[model samples]
Target: MRKNLRVAAYAICVRDDRILLARSPAADGTPEWVLPGGGMEHGEDPYDTVVREVEEETGYHVEVTALLGVNSLRRTFPGRLLRRPTDHHGVRLLYEARIVGGDLRNEVNGSTDLAAWQDLDAVTGLRRIPLVDAGLRLWRERPAGGRVQPP
Candidate 1:
């Protein structure tokens, strides 16, 4: 049994009735919206990871105010970079972050194609990555300082 703990940080950056999202670029160069942030590096704090990732992905400095919740997920990728039935359990720490500095700009050297604010309702109809809904739901009905069980 090969199990790897993948810790990641995500920020729910909201301002003026909209949320900041990174439009992920597909292999064919298509776009799909997702929450801003990414994986945490070894020995890095989750709080710092969220701030760093949000800035790197969305070009905005964020101040992580509260710890939302954790999510555990399993993924299997075949014919991918990661093979051999690896159990990737993620401890996703969501945060309520306020944009403190940095201009909103699409990172020229990054994974996403677009970095901008989008209507929260607009997300309902659009095709989004899994983490988007999870992050939003967590942001809306935040836990009473506890963990969110996996469904």
Candidate 2:
């Protein structure tokens, strides 16, 4: 068996009641909307990670406005036929951000295939990763401890 951990940053960029989002390929190779951010590099700060990821994934330069909250998730899955089971843990840092520059464009040669603004009211009806819901809760509620029970 193997254990793996991922610590990544995500942004909640809301403007005019629409949130900026990126559609990345999910585990089953289908597209699902997510906040525009990803894992930090070896020596990068979480703040820098959010800015860089937002640009790479959404072609938008962002300024991280606030540390929204954190969401942690864990899963254990069977590996390929001959391999052992693996434990995966993901810790996501959600930040509130504002777009500073750049245009809306889909990521090229990256995990995400599309980038677009989705209306806040219609988000619940979309097929999305749980992080989207969790991040939004953190953004709206602004809990004192900056933590939420991810859905």
Candidate 3:
């Protein structure tokens, strides 16, 4: 079996009855909403990954409160991808976080199309990254222990 290990972090930031989300540009330049965060750097702690990503994407310092859960998925790179498909896999670490400080400004180097607070109820109508569903599922189970580990 071909196995690939990747590490990424994501933050679920809730503020004043709304969630802070970043709208990222899709492969074709269309906008798709997603939580603000990104891949872990060499030797960087996962916790710090989320913090650093949040700042880079939204210019906001965030305080991670707890681990939401881990999401592992098997996926193949698009055939047109220049990289090898054997190297494709997703290992994401999602966390629940709160904004600490800094003004909400989009980073010039960011891949985000837009950044703004969206009403919780209206999120269903927006296009979201796949991980958002997993993150929200874990968030809903906040006090119920956590995702049942595979037996």
Winner by lDDT: 2
Instruction: Kindly list the per-residue Cα lDDT of model 3 for residues 65-126, writing each as its tens digit.
Output: 99988878776654444654465578888899998899898767667856788988888899
Superposed model 1: Cα runs more than 4 Å off: 26-29, 79-83, 145-151
Candidate lDDT (C-alpha), each = 0.82, 0.92, 0.82
| Candidate that scores best on TM-score | 2
lDDT (Cα, tens digit) per residue for candidate 2, span 42-108: 9899999999999999999998899988899899989898888999999999999999999989899
TM-score for each model: 0.87, 0.96, 0.87
List, residue by residue over 1-118, the lDDT tens digit for candidate 1.
4678888989988788898998887656677887888888989999999999999888888888888887768875444555566667877888889999999988777777788888
Question: Model 1, clash count?
Answer: 0
How many backbone clashes does every candidate have? 0, 0, 0
Instruction: Flag regions of model 2 displaced more than 4 Å.
Output: none
Q: Point out the higher-scoring one by lDDT: 1 or 2.
A: 2
Candidate 1: what lDDT?
0.82
